[model samples]
Target chain A: MAQPNPHNTYLPGYKEVGHHEWRTAENSAPYLLPTLQSLAETNPSLTLLDVGAGSGTITTSLAKYIPQGHITAIDLSPDILSRAASHAASVNATNITFQPASVYELAQTFGPAAFDVVHAHQVLCHLDAPVQALAQMLAVVKPGGVVAVREIDMRVWSFHPFSETMRAWVEVQKATHAAAGGSNEAGPSLVAWAMRAGARREDVKASMGTWLYATEEERRVWGTSFRDRIVGGEMRKKALELGIATEAELDRMGEEWQRWMETEDACCGTLHGEILIRKPK
Target chain B: MAQPNPHNTYLPGYKEVGHHEWRTAENSAPYLLPTLQSLAETNPSLTLLDVGAGSGTITTSLAKYIPQGHITAIDLSPDILSRAASHAASVNATNITFQPASVYELAQTFGPAAFDVVHAHQVLCHLDAPVQALAQMLAVVKPGGVVAVREIDMRVWSFHPFSETMRAWVEVQKATHAAAGGSNEAGPSLVAWAMRAGARREDVKASMGTWLYATEEERRVWGTSFRDRIVGGEMRKKALELGIATEAELDRMGEEWQRWMETEDACCGTLHGEILIRKPK
Candidate 1:
């Protein structure tokens, strides 16, 4: 049996969540590409640090932006890190390296003022000490280096025509996230977190972007992925164990999701807040 | 001299802002159309109560959605309402009727349960009593009717590459909005407001969407519009009179905005939250 993560309430199910996240990360290019391109504009050969690089999806995609640059990708899960390494190797992305590490230990391991750009996507929301981790990230970046973070504000996740099942699902998801010490408001709170982490308010720039799953194929993939996660994955198990939802409720939600996916005009929007802060030189 | 609206801080300059808003509303179809379509899905013949129908841009567009139904469009400003009526007449949209009314007086004017849909775009944020107005909207909406509201959370309005002038422009805009008794955080607070207005939590459905100005024409139009608003319009006068920004600062911001807009990859994202609350049958 795996040990329960004191900080993470969704343990024994993170691996499955991590797998789903890999797919989610892959489809996030629309949101991530622009930020990456912005960072690469000034220095194509920049050194990059990727925090919580699950399954190396974003990391590998990021590799294309900096052909001459090197990437250090870190995650806390050794299993996931190994899987990331294998994926990178299969892709012939030799410029990237995967290592098992925690956000808490970043500054200690990398020393101060280490990288040209530090980036994290959907990482801080899951951590117990997001501010401290952000501080660590800021500490390790060289002066004038950029620290970019992207996160979701799940409170804004809503659907129209008013489905009770979808609402219940959202509530359960939020509860599960909270139980795991995650911040559902992380996206909108990025700048405040950065400022709290000691970055100057004037240095932080915040913008909003979205990932819309509107096409048939996109909706199917998105809906089915959540369906599977809820039915057979750790989310189902944890949700039940935590008493956040009943098995019947989850099942009904799964059906509602499927029905929603089948509706011709059905679309989903995921809102993300992007913050880029440059350390004063 | 115009009476200073206790609830609105931008009274003296509202005419100019309202004119600018007309132009803005003309371009808002991409954001408002889908929501209207969704509400009209089951009921093609929708009797729509359009609150704050400035310039009749959205009201006329909405006429196409409910060809068989009628629209009651209202606004407080007689000048803008006249403009809206002229526009509606020019468009030959016979389904919409323009009137001067306040949100607080909706229920009294229309009586209980008069319309199938009560819709407002970017209106509630400008109200002194958003929740009370919401209650009035709810009162006049028939049972099982839908109340759709869209508002912006200006906090998410941002620009990249860190321009001090741009920041100042945003602050001035924010202050001007505050002076007008507008809620900069209204978009994210929709659901809460609905609940406070006595709607059941489950009856309210909230979703977020964005408008992006990234294409050359889009950037040019967006940039130039703001540039004009800042340099020559009443926003310029109010921003200076209120001491939110200096004339020189506004000039520099105008230049910086033009420069930002001209950048090849420059993109602007305007985040909006849409809520649909169904009256209990």
Candidate 2:
């Protein structure tokens, strides 16, 4: 539903099929963990709704912080949510419910005020109607609840010891973003969209963070895995179906990742931020 | 800097600047809020450290959720971190301690096991030595502490109702990724890089998510912003300086974003995911 690439890590069996999860916990912490902590502080008995909850990584964490809180997780793919359920079991987590649902159909599936916290992690950048999705989330959360979001603002990016290789590569990153209907400026947009939709400024908050990888091995190998296994696989299939790209485009997608593996150098990636809002009390 | 162009939200006397924070809060919540809930269930009292705590998006969240937990927020840019500190102050949050430091110098600045949780979102993709950044994070977290990451997996992308304009635009996208030492498949390698670097699979947890913009307006308007402002900007500046892309090639980037915008149809953009791992206890 998100992308045509079912083979991506965003799908399933990504790790088993030689896929990588980008930078691991070490590289991801500064931006992700603190934001998670900030989000958890909203309500003591928070009831959370995770739209597009893939593989249950965050679901398990929600169970840890809000032991008694209610959690309802949804995804368009049951195949993926099933794995998430398994993850919950692996972590011995309870108090969380999993379901298969699309963003467009969420209003019909969930009742009003069904959750104290309506959360979607890195979700909007992949949707056809991210703002509409946010609207739907607004509809689902209780009036007094909080709605939180996280996005990678690729627009605020910079580099060091830059090269032509880096420049060309960033273009690919933007292409990736364009095809997804995501703005490299998506993180900053959250605030304006919220206000336009009626949320006030005082109740809103936004922050920025990034993951910086230090090696070409980490960049290319992991980059290829992220592409073919997690994303490029899906894009290739989709473009082929759409006839937007020739066989060559698809092949190049595969080759680029390989080329990265063979090359030597490092990369830096920065995550812009997650903008969070508490529903009006 | 996480992005080459951050919409200049920091411009002096920029009232529209608040719009940045507002929109991020609005749009991001449809996803951001849920991720925090999921993270809460997983050892939320994390001795959290926020790297590049720009505007305090993640750092502030930590203060609210893990009120008793201590946070050492680090950033290299005084301007951005100052904004982060201000946001923390506005909320009267005290649990967070903001520091001016660089990810490259993290290990040298902190002692061993200094943190229980380290998280970054969309950061690793921008670094020259992303693995080294991860290594630094590993050096800080207690063995059992979780390190989580999130990034864009650009390969599964597509823009339907395709045209030559969209095709060229996509070409630019791929070029950007290839040049930046990034791969469409970089998302999954995140976990593998850690495992290969002495972390265990069982100790690792990875997940994926995405965002999609539905309307042409959402896709084109916000879409063109990133393409023109950052991706194109960075490439042209670098190309002109490095002599890789001629002035002609540099000019093409703008044409590309414009061409995509002119295409009238619903388009899809990027998909993303997360990789959460734990070092051996």
Candidate 3:
């Protein structure tokens, strides 16, 4: 039997209800399309690895880009990994293989130089050892292959009809994430993290992306989901356990989200930092 | 003679030193390309208006998209307008016409339904009356034409190798801009402003864009230009005038930029909000 994965302490657990709906792979993976398409064209039979492949949503959607390519999706939680496998089967994504693994153990599981591309989205920021995780990811990619990662640069979130409660919610969220040893605003630090992982600066390409929520429908989807996460989900549980916020305060935040959703002129956006690190040939 | 354009109190005057090189037209206008290209295809002889056409850098570049079209570039400052005219001449952008004008006078100057598109970039945020200016822009556009605007949503800036002084710099910049009666963070509120200016919610389309400076060269260019603006250029003058920061503090902020440029692991990004509103046909 294997020892437990310590990084399982990732805030806002994915198994929490509504996590799948709030962050689907299809919605989140569009930003990575162009790069993945280019890679697929360059190597039709590419072997790609998706670390921290929560819900396997992005991994399965990525399958069509290279019909001839194979994707091995891994997550720390077997429960989520099994669900991801069932999802891939239901979606007819025949090219993907699901497995349970840790981000820190990529080299041991796949051996060195095993993959053509190693990718993780919104993953690194949650780890206490992101630099080491990146190093392990770099170790498993073939020379001349690439490792791509994207994480929310949560330092600034833009919202309209701004409310004090919402602002407090953002602060509390960041505080809790930090207390758990994750970097909430990890977007801009990607290049530095890659460089620290032993990749040369020249081989790293850094860019920015964004997620916008406006219109009544978009606001409702994001607002209500976020409210649920804050009030009754893993985030709430973590906040209470960590004493980051009192139960009354968490309840107020949930109400604030409701108010925000009801406002006629509501808009919110979060910026993301993305990087592509090519293994030196 | 023109009552000294009240909006000319715009913070960080353009005529101030180093302004032109810091924000050239070409670098600032790429975000509007797809929209311009699509409009060009729809109407080859597109009669477009570039409001606040500072330095004519973006205006001259926009000329190529609609070779058959004509552009009337307007600004409140005759001094900058002359420079813009000279720039257009040097670049052989024969289709562009530069003139001295104010955002509030657009309808009176161009007449109603005079152009196919009225576009502004980094323009509206500096006004005491952005909604009125937007309404004027709408008035001058043809019934089916579009009015497009992009503004820095200054609410959040993402930077790496974070520093307290640099953070203080951001706060002071916002404060000075606000003191001048400008909305420094006009990006996210664009839709609200448009609606207040009489645009229907359905007719407005909102999106987000970003400016990234990460590479050594990029960091140097942005950092140094910003330092110049903070220490000796328009920003410094405005900061002192508004009493937002002491001279010594402003000097330190400028030095901080220099230090940041020298730091190998430097990255910064700013988010902008963009909107396109179509006149109801």
- Best candidate according to TM-score: 3
Clash pairs detected, candidate 1: A9-A180, B9-B179, B9-B180
Q: Name the better of 1 and 3 by lDDT.
A: 3
Report the Cα lDDT for residue B88, model 1. 85
Which of candidates 2 and 3 is the stronger one according to DockQ? 3
TM-score of each candidate's B chain against the true B chain = 0.86, 0.71, 0.91
What's the CA RMSD for each of the models? Answer: 13.9, 12.8, 3.0
Candidate 1 structure quality by residue, lDDT tens digits, A1-281 = 22222353223345344334444333443445665577678777778899888778888878877888899999878788788888888878899988877677777778889998888888888876788889889988989788888887765553432476877888877777776788877776776688789987668766666655544665687788778767766678878989888888899988887887785545566667777888999
Across A1-281, the per-residue lDDT of candidate 2 in tens digits comes to 23122211232223332222242222332333444455557655667888767777766765666776778999877877887888788879888899987666566778667777777766776554566777778778887677777665554333322445445445555555566565555654666566655677566664444444435545555566645632345554545554555676455545555555554332434444455667776
Question: Distance from true position, residue B224, model 3, in Å?
Answer: 1.3
Where does model 3 exceed 4 Å of error? A1-9, A14-32, A89-91, A242-244, B1-9, B15-31
DockQ of each: 0.07, 0.04, 0.72
* Shift in Å, residue B101, candidate 1: 19
Model 2, A85: alpha-carbon shift in Å?
A: 0.5
Which residue pairs show collisions in model 3?
B25-B57, B25-B58
Candidate 1 whole-model C-alpha lDDT, 0 to 1: 0.73
Order of models, best lDDT first: 3, 1, 2
Determine the C-alpha RMSD for candidate 2 after optimal superposition of all C-alphas: 12.8
Q: Which candidate is the best by lDDT?
A: 3
Largest DockQ belongs to which candidate? 3
Query: What residue runs in model 2 are displaced by over 4 Å at the alpha carbon?
Result: A1-43, A153-185, A212-221, A227-232, A240-253, A259-265, A268-273, B1-281
TM-score of 2: 0.46
Per-residue lDDT for B179 in model 2? 58
**Model 3, span B1-281: residue lDDT tens:** 12224565445564442334445434565556787789888889999999988787778877888899999999877878888888788979899998887778777777889998898988888888888888889989999888988888876889887889989899887987787788876988898999999999999988877778887888887787889888887778888887778999999999999988887767888888888898999
